[model samples]
Structure formats: C-alpha cells, structure tokens
Target: MVFESRGEKVFRFAILIVLGLLSVIALLPLLSVISVSFSSGWVVDLNQVTIWPKAFTFDSWQYMIDRPDLWRSFFLTLITTLIGTLLALLVTAMLAYPLAKKEFMIGGILMVGVVITMVFKAPIVPYFLTVRSIGLYDNPLVLIVPHILNPFNLIIMRTFFKQFPKELEEAAFMEGSGYFRLLFSFVLPLSKAVLATLALFYGVVLWNQFQHPLFFITDTDWYPLQIKIRQFITDPNEMPFLASRQEVNYNERTLRSATVVFAIIPVILVYPFLQKYFVKGAMIGSVKG
Candidate 1:
C-alpha cells in the first residue's frame, strides 16, 4: 500500500469515524426494538433502556406463539407474499421484455402509459369500488392483483433487459430461435440477478402490505400478520385479561416490538443469500439509455 500523507491519513480517519457513527445510529432503532421485544414487560424502566438487555425474557415470543390467530395471519402473509412476488415477476418480465426491444413500435406508448399510471394514482374509493365491482374485494387477489406489475420495477427490468448484448440475440435469431425460445433459454438465465432483486422487492412489499387488507378484507380469518399486530396494539380491549388489574398488564410497547421483530425475521433470513444479486441487479437495472 502507498504511504499516506498526514493530512490524507487524518481525512481518511475522519471519514471512517463518520461512517462508523452513522452505521451505529442507523442500527440503534433496530437494536432498541430487539431489546424491547426481549424485555420482561412493556414498561421497561428508563434505567433499563440501554444497548444491551437489562433482563432477558421470552414472554413476548411465548405470548405470540400461543396465539392461533397470529399464526393464521402469519400463514396468510406468507401465502400472499409468495403468490404476489411470483405473479409480479411474471407480469413485470412479460411487460418489460417487449418494451426492452427498440423495434417494438408501441413500446414507447406502453412505457408512457406505465409512467402515467405511476404518476397519477387513482383515488382509493374509486379503486375500491372497481375492485368490488370485479368481485375481488375479499379475496387474496385484492392484495396481489393491484400490485402485480409495479411500474418502477417494470422500468428497472426493461432497462436490465435492454443492457443484454445484442450479439446474443442476433446469434439466437441466426439459429432460427424465436423470441419466446430466446427469452426462456438465454435471456432469463442471464437476468437472474435482476429478477432476484425484483422478487425480493416485491416479496418485501407484499409481506408488509397492511392497508389493502385493512380495507378490502373484512374477515378476521383473512387478516395478514401486520393487520393482526396493528389490532393487538390498537385494540388492547380485544385481548384477554387486559381488562383486569389482577393480571399482568400486557406491555403493548413490548408486544409491538416483538411483532416487528417477528415480521422482519423472514425478510432478514433470506436477504443475505440474495443481497449480492440485489446490488448487481440494481446497478444493471438503473442504467439509462
């Protein structure tokens, strides 16, 4: 390594210190949430609110585990995330692939349409009315269908596909391979990084979706985990033993923290595997013409 001047060394050290501080600041909230979740009760004393847990307890986790409704909601969330991400990927790929081609006459028009849709979101009431009219109001389709092809994701995928080497497509065409065959055999395999990135994006969105289910789904059985957590936090009266002073006051704060911890665990678990792909994909997808 080249020797650094004193000034350069000082500058580099300053930058490193700033970055370290920023990282800790960013991580503080997550660490606090985890601490609260594992804390014995909701009203953690001010003295105990440190980086490390004052006293550890699994009561929050135990409480959540014993709730059948929470489990059901979690299952619903998983199903919705899986189905929504897969569908979103398919629809995004289909729309993006043709748009990626310069030869496609209507590609520009379609792209403009997508941009317009992204810019001007329809009012909630009218959208809800339309969903009800289409008879998808209570179904899981209500959540998945509305977001099947996110415009930003479409744009990213289109950009990624456009970056593919023209020579590859030309060679495939020379071999008499059709568009679908080329897409299936060559384009898709090469685009896995971008696809994985989009999948994670869509999956996270689906998993965290709360408003759609809150409005469209009336049945308690169909509520997603987020909705369930919201209900628990907001409507403490609905929870058993909360009305009596003889029982331990369920710490809503602690419960909320636990719920958040549980909610994020699935995404956290899968992120490391796909993180490499995410960065590569984002770089490829953000390239402008």
Candidate 2:
C-alpha cells in the first residue's frame, strides 16, 4: 500500500471539507423549499422559515394534489422527458456512427458543420419567425422537435463511437448484418453507459425547460409544469385555494413552495438509477481514445 506524506493528508482533508460544504450549499434551496412547504402560511409570509417548519401542516400539499391542472402539466412534462430522451439518443447515435467511421468521405465536412452550430446560434427573432413559418408555432411539436438533438451531446457520442471496436462490427457484417443491424444489436446495447448518462442529462433538461415553452406555446392546455409554476409565483389568484382564504391556514407562499418541491422531486428520484454509469461515461466521453 502507498503511504501519504503529512502535507498530502492535510491537503486531502481540506478538499474533503470543501466538498462537504459545497454539497450542503447545493441542497440548501431544496431543503428550504421543503421546509416552507410544510410550514404554516403565516410563518411563511413572515419569512420565518429557515430549515425547519414553524407550524407543520399538509394543507398546501393537499390543495396542490387536488388540482387537475397540476396533474395535467406534470404528465405532459413527464411524457415530453421520456419521448425527448429516446429520440435524442436515437438521432445522436445514428448520426454519430457514420461520422465515427474513417471511411465516410463527407464525415469531416458534416462534423465541421455540426461544430459550427455549437459556436454560433441563430438570432432570436429570425429563429422565432422561421419556426413559426414552418407551422410549429403553437403546436406541441414545439417542445419535442426543436430539442431532438443537442450539438454538445452529439459530439460526445461521436467520440464514444470512435472508440468502439471494429472486430465486432466486422464480424456482424460477415454474418450479413447491415449498418442499422449492427447499430441496434451491438453498438447501442454495449453503449448503455454513455446512453444512460446522456438520457439522464436530456431528461433533466427537458423536465426543467421553462423559457422555450413560454416563447413557443400560447395555448393554455399545452402548458407544461414550469409554466404552471410560473403562474403560481407571479399570480397567486391562479391558485384555487385562495378562494377560501378565510377558512384555510395555508396561504400563497405555502402553495408555491409545495409546487416547487413537486416539480423537482421526479428528477431527484431518477438520479440514483443512472448514477452508477454517470462518472465512468462522463470521463470516457470527454477525452480522445
């Protein structure tokens, strides 16, 4: 076993302390939201909540649970996350395969074109007009289509595919398998580490997407959870519980905290399942083979 010098041990201890503090700092907002969600509305209004509930209650959660709009928005966001992750993974993998191949002549040109998008983005107004002109203005495809492939993700996947084994692919071709067959049967199944990591990344981004929906979607029925959460923050009148303000102990702050808590819960729950693959995938994809 290797032994550490006294200085090295001290430095390691300092790094550990910093990381522990940073982890707590990262969780502070989430803990505050949970605390406020359970606190009495009056205590919340007074800004009395720190890390613990002043007067613990479940009124806000019950109110949010009973609202049909909340459930509708929640399911819409969930569906979008699932569909977006799968489509993005498929498109990214398919496009990366040929580009990873040294034999594909135009692959260099195409790779340059894709990299250019990473460096430059289209102007907002023109982009808006272009999307609208194509008939995606107010459609639900506004959510799914635009985010089908992220350029950075595409690049990472290309790098991963470049390091893939040629022997397996050659054997598959000898057995009469085509490009699509090799990709579906061999590449994808073996690339689960990277794919799972990217899936979690895409899923989180789609789930928390707020700005795009506001710009593209005006139809109330098509609104996702983020839009609904915005309403909770800006206009408390949109919350149904306020109609009976005199009867219930819960107020606007309590309900808003509850909504915020609900919005982030799904992502937190999903992280652990994919976490085992995250570090390995991330490090391997970041560097050349």
Candidate 3:
C-alpha cells in the first residue's frame, strides 16, 4: 500500500480552491445580465441589483418578438453567417491543401507569402475601394468575399492537413483517385473536427459583424442584428415603442440590457450544439504542426 504525502494533499486542495474561485468570477457577469433581463420593471435599480431577480417578467423578450424589423435583422444575420462560414471553409481548404504538400513546386514561396500577408494587414480604405471597384460593395457578397480566405484559419487547416498520414495519399494516387475526389471523399471526412471549429468561428464573426454594415451597407432593410442594436441604442426616437414611451419613461440602462440579452441569445443557443466539436477541433488544429 502507498501513502499520500501531507504536502501533496495540501497543494491539490489549493489548486481546486483557485479553480473554483475563477469559475465563479467568470460566471458572475453572465448570471447578472440574465437576471436583469428577466426583471419585471423598466428600470434596474443599481443599488438593489442581485444575482436573483426581485420580480420576474418576460416582457422584454415578448417586445423583441413583436418587432418585425428585429426579426428581419435576425434572419439576415443567420443567412449571412451560414453563407459566409460555408464559403470560408471551402476556400480555406482549397488553399491550405496545396500549401500543405512538401512536394508542391512553389510550396515554400506560397507559404512565405501567406505568412507575410498574415503579418501585414492591408489598409482598410484601399480594400474598401477595391471592393467597390469590383462591384461587391453593399452586396451580400461584400460580407463574405473579403473574409473568405482568412490567413489564420488557412494556416491552422494547412497544419492539420500536414499531419495526415503520407501513406494514405500515396495509396489514393495509386488507386487513380484524382485530387478533387480524394479531397472531398477522404480528406474532408477525416478533417470534420477542425472544419467544424473553423465554421463556428467564421459564423460567429459574420453574425456579430457591425463595422462592415455600418460603413458599406446604407440600406436599413439590409442591416444585421448588431447594427440594429446600435441604432436602437443610439437613436431611441427611431424605435416606435421607445418613441411612444418617451414622455412617460426613458430608462436607457434597461433598454441596453434588453438589447444585449437579445443579441446574446443566438450565440448561447449555438454553443451547446457545437461545443464538443469546438474544443477538439481547436486543440487538433492548433497543437499539431
């Protein structure tokens, strides 16, 4: 029988305590936001703020659902996220696979170019001008085209591809499997974990994108959820309900919290389904090659 040392037991207990404290601290803000969102009144009393709500209400959520413009923006965000993520994953895999091959004639030079582009971001104004010149400005493609080939995602995918067993590629070549067939049939199937991670990342970025729509897209009907939230917060007069209630009540804090809660709901709903793939994908993609 083996006996545990007193010092080792004390060290383990200290580590557990630190981890527990950190977890509580991280969860506190999210818990507070949720509590405030469900509170009954229009005003949140800062002095009376607590983790548990004093009075409960679903009025804010109901109000959000009643607004047609908000629902339209939500759908726009969803469509954009799906389209952009798909395009990004497809383009990234196409570019990364070739770069991952050592036998490719220009692999070294191409890799260097990719690294340099990642290091030196192009000026936003010039890029915007180029997009306008190409007739993509203010178009749905505008959201996707500029970010389709993210260098960081490409690098991670290339590293993952490089880690694939070389013998598999050789056997596929001997079986007369063309690159396209091999890529779709074999490579992609095995790379699901990393691909799922990148898709989630790209989707989230596209869903939360505000600056692009604010600058390039002028049409109010084409605005995404984030831009809508910004507009609501900035110009309450533009919101019909708020404008109607302007004389009686004007509580900015409660409105802000409501908007935040609405914006976060989609992300929260998405995380649970994709979480298992996310951690594994990130670990495999980042820690390898």
Best by TM-score: 2
lDDT-better candidate, 1 vs 3: 1
**Deviation in Å, model 3, residue 97 alpha carbon:** 0.8
In angstroms, give how far residue 134 of model 2 lies from its true place.
1.8
Poorest 10 consecutive residues by lDDT, candidate 3: 246-255
Count of backbone clashes, every candidate in sequence: 0, 0, 0
Candidate 1 contains a number of clashing pairs equal to 0
lDDT of the candidates, in the order given = 0.85, 0.89, 0.80
In order of appearance, the predictions have TM-scores of 0.90, 0.95, 0.88
lDDT per residue for candidate 3 within 1-289, as digits (tens), equals 8777999989989999999999999988887777776675544654354666545666666666778998888888888788889989999999889888887899889888988998898898997788789987677667667767888888889988999898998899999998888888899999988898898888888988877887688788888889998888789675446546644332455556677788888888988888888898888778866
At residue 39, candidate 1 shows an lDDT of 77
Please write out the lDDT profile of model 2 over residues 156-242, one tens digit for every residue.
888999999899999999999999999999999999889988898788889988878999999988889999899778985786656
- Which candidate, 1 or 3, would have the higher TM-score against the true structure? 1
- Cα lDDT for residue 26, candidate 3: 90
